[model samples]
Target chain A: MFGKKRVAIVGAGVTLFRRNLKETGKELSYEAAKTALEVAGLELRDIKSVVMGSAPDAFDGVHMKGEYLADGAGAYHKPYTRVFVGGGTGVFTPLAGWWHVASGQFDTCLVVCEEKMSSCYPHPQYAFTTIFDPILERPIGMNLIWIFALEMNRYMHKHNIKKEDIALVSVKNKRNALDNPIAQLAANITVEDVLNSEIMAWPVQRLDVSPTSDGAAAVVLASEDVAKEVTDNPVWIDGVGWCIDSTHWTDRDLYYPDYVECAAKMAYKMAGIKNPPKEIDLAEPYDPFDYKELHHMEGLLLCKKGEAPKLTREGVTQRDGDLPTCPSGGLLGCGNPIAAAGLMKVCEIFWQLRGEAGKRQIPGDPRTGVAQAWGDLMQYGSVIVLRR
Target chain B: MRYYQSEAVETKDIKEGKIPTEKFRPKAKFAWSAGIAISRFLEELKNGKIIATTCSKCGRIMVPPRIYCEKCFKPADGWKYVKDTGVINTFSVSFLAADASRLKEPIVVAIINLDGASEGMGIVHRIEEYGDWREVKIGMKVKAVWKPPEERTGAITDIAYFKPIRE
Candidate 1:
């Protein structure tokens, strides 16, 4: 891994995370890409290539969706590539961009991610039906909420963790998101409010879920040679790794994200990170569901296995505490717009690394950070390590 | 053929047993962002016009324009709008519609890679007035049929379907 090239995310930008957008997906992409380009001090013309990622063609209600999003990402004349790993697409977007530069090929790459979940009629959750096997899974009438409920149940059963212990994550993250500019569900609420909320599929309360959103986030990546010339605070993408488990999601242990462990090992190995719990200063482990953040924490080796709920309960994961995670409020607080939400996690790390996150910045001088997004039939973990 | 139903129904009631079973069907709806190139391309289609996004990095003139060239790493430059006519790439006989309801007749589902589009790039739609599945074949010539202006809505079905042109 010595010859592994250095990939730096010089700039990042995001549109307002919301439920509905008047602007179609392309306009959102333009808005986000413009901001990222401005931060990177480059125009669409300067981008040598484009890497675009969105969850599924079904969510967008458009077929050949990657090609549909190409121009919006300023990919029309560039060597454009689209890689999607379900909800992992957001994190994977930059990973795709990272490879473009790390391979000693491209210089400037614009990585864009967008998801408009509002368009799916009745409810956005209906879109999840297509994620299942048309032949077998669909026959059971599986909805996405049930899988989350089962995972939460197993997590609760395994850790001897009470419902109240998990509520703290929603409370803390939402409170932390108050200062976030693009926060969607940022609010101040007690654990009682969470428990009192509507239970969609048992164990998984409606409040525990991230709001369906329409959002886009873009990041510009360049080689170290060119990045140094543009900005002094170039956050290096030290390592990136993604792993997906088998499709039989029902057969796997729902208590943890097993794929995340392998993905984290791959990334930690590349970044030369020995003790993630001590070495990595901050993290934004994907939290589309409250328990998932804790699930990814253990998988990322932030603490010993099954210790995340305890860490979460004791306020260790808070912005002001040891190992501040999801200081940008996270998808649970800010919003979950599929791919955009994941990149938002990546952007927060960049801000923390540069001391430019303003009110959302972590307490200490955070030199090392990791962002992980897991999705795709609930079996993928896309991990990234960035260091200042 | 006509005498079997009444006797079979009476005999089935007299047979040993029948097991209770179940079947499931879900109505799937998805909202998608058309993005820039394709949205514009779709809008132009409603106006009886065709648009293609060409990657300057790679000279692929793509119908249903792409934001990125998937092949080259760069922003697309050339914008070419043309008449609506393309050759059939692949097709099938749809025995049932989206609702899983039976149709009076089977419709022809087709994938058409418009003449100017890149390799294997095109739109999926029904081949209008093809009579039946037996009539249409791969590589059949077809052209767009515009709906009346009053009936226009911004969707794929705006142009009823492509039909065989009188060449």
Candidate 2:
């Protein structure tokens, strides 16, 4: 899709997602970067540029987090840039690296994403309080869950969707996580278990939420010539797109994500996907919450508006289903370290595409897939399409 | 292919200082300006009235007034006093606080679309005077329960909470 040089992902790596990891964010970044380099059969000297993606500095309790993480991301005295778009940093980081290679500016670029939510005192959720407007929303004493609860409630009301339908997403994802070695919340749970779980807010139950976690993920991107030289089976980055809605989230209807649809449309146009459900063999939309998977699927144009829940009910999104979704178990089952979790979805797509997923691999030899993330006051969407 | 590795630490490790952790409590606070449009809105609240901004371009009556109309990208034309009464667009019975602490009493939060404001323009506030959240619904009519004029500051809390207009 590039005039100068097509970009391809040669290697990818992910660290274990957990509540508290002894490794610092830099150390985690180094571990993932080292693994990706090793897998790509490339050395630090071979990398011409570096890209880092991390969420708010408040979570890490460190300012200028990009500069702080440079050495760890293997950017010592090299051209390095950091990407932050709330939770979209993960997939977005690789897109930045793609620009470097696709523009023919660099032969190879190393992309790393890391988050250490465990560093925050008391709880990580406290850092999110600062995300709201101090003049209006902050004074109301909003917990992060409140926004999701409000959106979930509105979504349910608008579509006349049942809680039973939403709970199925949690059940499917958690069960899918059982096969993933690095997954944190992989469990054999039921829709009843989700409904009976402790309610954080009226509509959001404990099981509906993804836990705060610490981890890192990395990937190696190279130009077409370099990709063929380094690896025989390189997964090409077919398309990339991102879009942000107005910061005034309250004024807009929260029933569905218009931004995600805009982003997917941009990507689909680039990938030449006229019909998403028919052309895209796999999907890994962000699933920080159970219903979000359905929300994002519709946003990605994988199904009709409000038709995602019905597909989930019919088991169409299962790993073995016609259209496999979140075969990595997603953030709902896997831990969510914000930026790192998004990159993990990209890594999952790379693995599934190359037939390296082992137990989590789908039966069919899927050739095309998309990974997407939503972030920032529920106003941002980042998407990437990969093909073998 | 071999992949993924990390060491998990327990809470006691940090509490006992076994993990070599440094504790931080941020004191870098700021007194943010209420800006041009909201400064007047907050001032009106001090006088026990709710104010909104009207955009001549898009013709939107926006609550929590902004200097510019987001849709048309033009300056707002004028201001008007919106009624303190509205309908609940959406709400949640939150059992947890900002710090992830379980609250002794669950808070009922709602986004209320003010009566003189344009459609879909809502301000977030608390829902009160109801015994249970089950009594609340998306379309329930509500009115702002303002604090006494003397107790009011030019802040969002001037209206203590929104209660049911019916009961």
Candidate 3:
């Protein structure tokens, strides 16, 4: 939709996704931002604007967290803004950065995403309490797992999908994570292990969910001219789309993500992609939970409704499969630091497109890929398409 | 780029106080006003009634009543009482507490779509009178089990929980 100045991602970097990192949230952002600048062959002085994406202020236990992390994000004296749409913030960060360059307002923009989930006391899950509707949903003392389980149950019932079929996603992602240096829960396990894992909520087990983590990711966005000077191969930002559904989650059917489809359609329209399943080479749909990956695949129109499991069973989503998905291990395998997880997907796409992913790189030299992130009571979806 | 790495910390080290940590607990508490829709809804709840707001334009009877219709972006036409009975839209048996601690007994929570409300419009609440978790199925008929009037309060908890309606 943005037919103005073309924007390209010239550089990307990410910190290790872990349970507890000694560095503060700002330090993490600085580390990722510094690395991104180095890779882009530019200094902090060259950046004209900065865009910050963080999941929640509660995760860092810092109010007005954007301002607090601004200096570390290389936003000193620069026009900076924070974009938040729960976990969707990561890809949304770059989308905001794209606008800075596409609008001809800035030649170079630094996009940073960070999440320090360990800072929440007792348990990080406690911070999620506020995300619920206080008078309606919160009064019943609801936890995050309850909602995921509820949705999973509905999806399974609608499709007649067994828990074992969904467990395959966890197995595949964890095994894939074994190749990722920054992965937290990368493992070699069978679907049996996932099915046998401790049940946090029925149909939703411990192994099925992504771990709460602390990490940061960053990328450098530049206009066509700046991108040409910075790198010989630039991952062009072809399209960006985001959508949000009603906060009244109970008022809508949970079987399908209509919002995700809406966002994907918007992105596809901008990218001029008529057939996502055929045209897109690879994908990284948000997978906070195992079933969610499959749910999102359907939402992104990568596969038909209720047919993702069959494709997954046929190994169509493997790293070596025809349409590789989540080759960077994804949030399930890589570790979910909320905003950073989504940006991590974007970073993976960058490396994969440039054939620099080393161990995790897919066999084929894929040219186009899509990364999406979802969050906020299953209300928001953010999508980005990148072309080499 | 190949040499890039991030620093990590061990949980044991932080637990042993090996790292300097600053503790700050926020005392910030919020008293949110329920406003016209929810205030009246809560009053109705105390009177053992489930109320919903209807938007004349879109004809959506929204639960947890709102002053304005979300779809039409117009003021809700009026309030209407919904049946205490509902069907289970979806449910879960949670073994974890709100604080991530293990619970001694699992609680069955469900989103129950009330009869008189618009399709898919429902309230989230606990389910009771079911011993086996497997028995709780979607589309099962349920009715609100309200607390006695003397113990009733103008809150969502006033209705207590919903139980399966006997055939």
lDDT of 2 by residue, A151-192 (tens): 899989988999999999999999999999889899999999
- Judged by lDDT against the true structure, how good is candidate 2? 0.92
Per-model TM-score on C-alpha atoms: 0.70, 0.98, 0.99
lDDT values of the candidates? 0.78, 0.92, 0.91
Over A1-388, each residue of candidate 3 has an lDDT whose tens digit, in order, gives 4757899999998999999988888999999999888889899999999999998888777889999999989999999999899978888889889889999999999999999998787888888888998887788999988989999999999999988999989888988888888999999999989988998988789999999898999999999999999899899999889999999999999999999999999889999999999999999999999999999999999999999999899999999998888888889898999998999999999989998988888987899999999998989988999999
Q: lDDT by residue for model 3 over B1-167, one digit each (tens)?
A: 33247778887788788988887898899988878889999999999998999999998888979999888899998999999999999999999999899987899999999999999999999999986888999999999999999998899999899999979
Candidate that beats the other on lDDT, 1 or 3, i.e. the better one: 3
DockQ of 1: 0.01
Off by over 4 Å in 2: none
Query: What shift in Å separates residue A312 of candidate 2 from its native position after superposition?
Result: 0.6
In candidate 1, what are the lDDT values of residues A206-325, reduced to their tens digit? Answer: 678788888889899999888998999999999888998866454345667878999999999999999898899999999998888888999998998788888988889998889998
The TM-score of candidate 3 is 0.99
Off by over 4 Å in 3: B1-3
Give one digit per residue, the lDDT tens place, for model 1 in B83-144.
Answer: 56877655545433343334566566555667766654566566777765566766688998
Instruction: Please rank every candidate by lDDT, starting with the best.
Output: 2, 3, 1
Pick by TM-score: 1 or 3, better one: 3
For candidate 1, the chain B TM-score comes to: 0.75
- The positional error of residue A379 in candidate 2, measured at the CA in angstroms, is 0.4
